[model samples]
Structures are given as structure tokens and as C-alpha cells.
Target: MPRRRQAVTIRHVAADAGVSLQTVSRVINKEPNVRPEMMERVQASIAKLGYVPSIAAQRMAGSRSYLIVALNDRERTIAGWRNREGTDWVDQMLLGGMLTCAEHGYRLLVELVDTHNDHIARELLGAIAAIRPDGVILTPPHSDNPHITQLLEAQGISFARIGSVKPGAGFAVAMDDAGAARLATDHLIALGHRRIGFIAGPNEYELSGRRVDGWRAAMAAADLPTDHLLEQGDFGLASGRAATLALLDGPVSPTAIIASSDQMALATLELARERGLEVPADLSIVSFDDTPIVRFVHPSLTAVVQPIADVTAHAISLVIAEQAGQSPSTAPVIVPATMAVRASTGAPGAARPGGGEAQGYAGPPAGAGIVTEVSSDH
Candidate 1:
């Protein structure tokens, strides 16, 4: 019979590195002041042995679980996956969050919970009891949920809120959603589109309102009438289609339309085709999130590319930092979002200046992205 390899643990790493068990723990927890050469040697030994530290052992070795919990909207996320619509928000989040957590010797865990669950406290408590995460991150609808924030507050857990600007308990790590929306709207306005239409996300999300506000503000600034040009969507394909239909069938036909989500934007594109209108020629379209699929469409979408990975990484850092008693109480993060000019948008009568296909914008140089870190009493 083949021999079974024993599971590798921190002790094996310590023994192989010829260091004290505590030294290995320090390296695992990313504690400061460890000698550089010792850290290297310990890490080298761990790699050689393929030592995967046990999370339970980690919990026992310290007051932390070394786990960062991220809460996402349960219903919407599931629907997106089940329908195979394939939103890349979670993927981008993992790319940024997992990498950041690994650097800090932590793990990123995602939990799906109903945003409006009446037993929200119980759901949160159960998850909290099971994982005992070092910190929590609230995304989208949950970010604006006061109940979750209140419970996390009562339980003394460090959390970070993404896509929220409300003054609350958890650290607020947010994107410039409004600024990004304004950027998109302004781009369309500059392209000689007079009557631009705007489709907004659901009211449950705070960022949705912020985006709508930006679009409205930009239109008002351009001295253009926004009457009959705004429609509401739930960030879903069906809702987007309904909203797009209303905008197209309204009193005045808009030359350009901006949908607040990739799904919604795709719906707009679909609706336009149904109406026999050419993208960016007969109609110009812009959308948000800059999802991966948008680039492959017949008329690639012009999108507001929020720095998803960088923003997520920054949020993870803030959560871990706050848990470690570091500062950054209530400063606004300024992660800049860029407009990816594509074939979908144009000068009302003409296609966008370049070839319709375009690459998503890579974010700014490292260390320049601003992230809001809200500190807690904990």
C-alpha cells in the first residue's frame, strides 16, 4: 500500500525552520518587527513542506480567526449565477481581496444573506459564531442595511462598508460612484448628444441614488432638459429592458442612454437592436461596472470602469488594519473610476471616434487610489 502523507501544520514549519513555535505564529499572523532573514527562512520552510495552516489552529493561537468576511446580496447573486448572466463583480473582488488577504496572512470568505431578511440578526450571529471572522465587509444592498450594522456593532465586530456613504459604525470604504456616473454622463454630453437618457439601479442601493444624482447634476449643468429621460431599473435584465422601453417610447427620443449596470446596459443594447437601431449610429449607449462580457459584444459597451480590484483590495486592507488597532476613523477614499470609450457611445450622428472595440481601463498607478477607511469604537 502507498504511504499516506501526514498533514503539515505550523509546528512542522517551526521544526523545519529551527525556530520557536511563537516565531512561526508571528510570521503567519504578519506581526511586525520579525527579522527579515528569519521571515524568509520560515516562509521558505513552509513552502517546502507545503504547510497549509489550519484555520482552527490559527484561531486557537490568537484572538483572531484571520478570516475576513464579505457579505453579498443573496438573491441577486444567485439569480445572476443561475441564469448564467455571469457578473464579474465577485470575481474581481476575489482577485483583489484574496490577494490582499494572502499578503496579510488572512483569508477572504464570502457569505450570501438576504438583504432584507427579517431575522437578519440571527443570520448574522450564526455566521459570526461559526467563523468568528476578524472583520466583515458589506457590499451593495447590505452596505446600506442599518440592521446588520447595528448587530455587528452590538457584537463588537470590525466591518467595512463598500458603496455606502452613510455615517455609521463600520469603516466606509467606497468608490466614487457619483463621480464615475458624472464622468459617464459628461462624456456623452461632450460627444454632442443633447437629449441623453439615464437608467438607474434600484433604490435599495445607496450607490444607485448617488449615480442618478450625478447624471441629473451633469444634465442640469449642461443646461439640458432631463424631463422624460430618466427611468428606474432594479439592476436586472428584465427591469433594464422595461426601463429601456419606457425611455425609447417616451415623449422625446433620447439620442444617448446610460444604464447603471452591465446587465441593464446589455438590455438597452438588445432593445435597440429590436427597434432596428444601430448602436452609436442611431443610438449611443453607456453602462456601468465594465463587466468582462461587455467587451465581447457586437458593439462593445462604453462603460464606467470603477477600480473593482483595487477598491476591493483597499477595503480588505482597511478592515484588517482596523482590527489590528490601526487608525483611519472616517476619511473618504478616492478610488478614481475611468471611462472606457468603446463602440457603444458616439457623437449622436457618428460612432465613437476610435474603432468600436476597446480595452477596459487599467486603474491608476499603485498607491494613488484613495480608499475611505471608517474606524469603529471597537
Candidate 2:
């Protein structure tokens, strides 16, 4: 007759090790104050018996684990938001969240979602039900989405937004887009640029709107005319190039141009080159989001630098505090922008019209183009 197969159990581990069940339980659970030798013995016995703790049993015992789920909009991609090559906002966000979680003995889960559909909140709700995370972190357009916000609220799932929200929202951590835009505009105005043009980003994002609004407000406050010189782009390099061309070819061109992002600003520079126009001397230019590569270009770009790491850190802190049952901070931080000057801007010396070309500093004449150093607080 075949030998009877032995049943495997926690009791078997205790019996085989000649220890009581309570000692084995303490060892298996990693409870505090277990003797070193006793823990070793219990572990050895558990290995011998092939004893595995059942997750189901732990859940039924009224114990719950902490989890944080981060949700990002899949439709939009943020430059310098990745972890590779240069400093990325995503890595900083993860780092801050991980550090906070480790300190509080919590777990973090990341989720990327597409915002094209109308029911993203529904999908997020499903994820919440499946993972049962303590809270969720929303980024970009998703933070402004009313559907997801309502669902998360109705379900009693705590959530934090990673970008600036309208005034009166309880919890959000983000840079002041309008404030940043005002600073960028102020920089150009101080540099003697009266005919300043703005290249607007996509209208789909709230940041885009806020940035443009800030530009208008600043220009008006400075007694500058807000006229047809402004053009809109889709926040892509190509769109920026097209918009730059439009503004340049118009009857009333601006002496200086502010592209909403580094990518768009780079495109403007490229367009200036294609049109045989010069930078700074002929047409001063500035961009936002002092991304890493902006400094490495042929002519370092003048830009408004956002405090990416600080913004993300604040967001993570809020999320972790709520997860750990701590009172949330009163107001979301509105980080300031730094104005980084490089070779991309100059005093308004070039004539707008009449005396021939788009009169401004046109780099070095023709083939003798001079490369300039880029300055950024990256």
C-alpha cells in the first residue's frame, strides 16, 4: 500500500519544532518581541512543513493594509516628467510618495488612465473597489475632471490633486500657472519689450487657460495693448512653429514672443531660423518650464522655471498625511517661478517695422552664428 500523504498545517510546524502554537504564530506574523532563536526555530519548522499564511485568513481577522493609488492622464505627456536622462517629475513624485509611505508603514500603487472617455471616474471607481486603496492621487486634466472628483467623493475615497485647482478646493498641490505666466511676461517687459506676443498652449487644459489669462492680465496692468499679435498652439513644437510664423508674418508683429512651454519655444527658435530672422537682437523670445535640455540648445533659452519637485513633494505629503489619519494641511502650496535668463532675450532695440526687416538682434550675421550659454536652476 502507498504511504499516506501527510497533511501540512501551522500546527504541524509547531509539533515538528517542539514549540507551542503561540510561538509559531508570533514568528509567522513577525510580531514584536520574538526571541531570535525561537524565531529561527519556528521559521525552520515552517519551511519543513511548507506552511504558508493565508491572505484570506488575515483579511477575515479584521486587519487592513494601507495602499495609495496614483492616477495620471494618459492623453497628455509631460516633458521632463519621466525618470530617465534628466530630472523627471514622475520620479520625484514617486520618491516623495515612497519615502512618506515607508515612514508611515503604508503601500503605494500607481495607475495611469486615459481621459478621452466620459466614464474615467467609473473606471477609477472600479479600480478603487478592486485595490481598496486608502486614497488616490490625481494629476493634470484628471484633477479638473468633475466626474472623477464626484465619484471619489461619493465613495468616500480620499484623493489629492497634483496641479493647481480653482480657489476653494480643499486639497491640491501645484504651481501657480497664472503667477508663473505673469513673471515670464514681467521679465520681457522689464527687458524693454513693449510689443510682446504670446504663443498660447492648448485650450483643453486648465493650465493653458490660466497661463494665457495671466499673460493678458500682466500685459494690461503694464499698459501694453492686448491685440491680434497673440496666437494659439496645441503645445506641440510643430504647432508652435506654425503659430510663430503666423505672428511674425502679421502686419503688426511683436518685438518679443513668449511660448508657453520649452518645446514650443524651441519650435519658435527653429521658425526664426527658417524665416532668416534673428533671436534676441531681432526678436526676443522666452519660454516656460525650464526643462533640462533648454540650456543645451545652440542659443540657451530664457524661461520661467517651475519648482517641479517641490510641487510634487507637497502633493505626496498631503496624500500620506491623509492616509495616515493625520489632519490635512489647510492650504495647497502655490510655488513660485524662477526667471532664468540666457541668450534668448535682449533689450528692445530692433524697430518693429519701416526700416526694412523685423529689426532685432539677429544672432551673428548669417554663418557666423554665436552659441550662447543656457542658465537654469534645474
Q: Each prediction's Cα lDDT score?
A: 0.83, 0.72
For TM-score, the strongest prediction is 1
RMSD in Å for all candidates: 6.5, 8.7
- Summarize candidate 1's per-residue lDDT along 25-138 as a digit string, tens digits: 888777777999999999999999999877788788679888999998899899999999886998988899999999887899999999778888898899999989999988
Task: Tell me how many clashing residue pairs each candidate has.
Answer: 5, 4
TM-score of 1: 0.86
Worst 10 residues of 2 by lDDT: 369-378
Candidate 2 structure, TM-score to reference: 0.72
**How many clashes does the backbone of model 1 have?**
5
TM-score of each: 0.86, 0.72
Off by over 4 Å in 1: 1-19, 35-52, 351-378
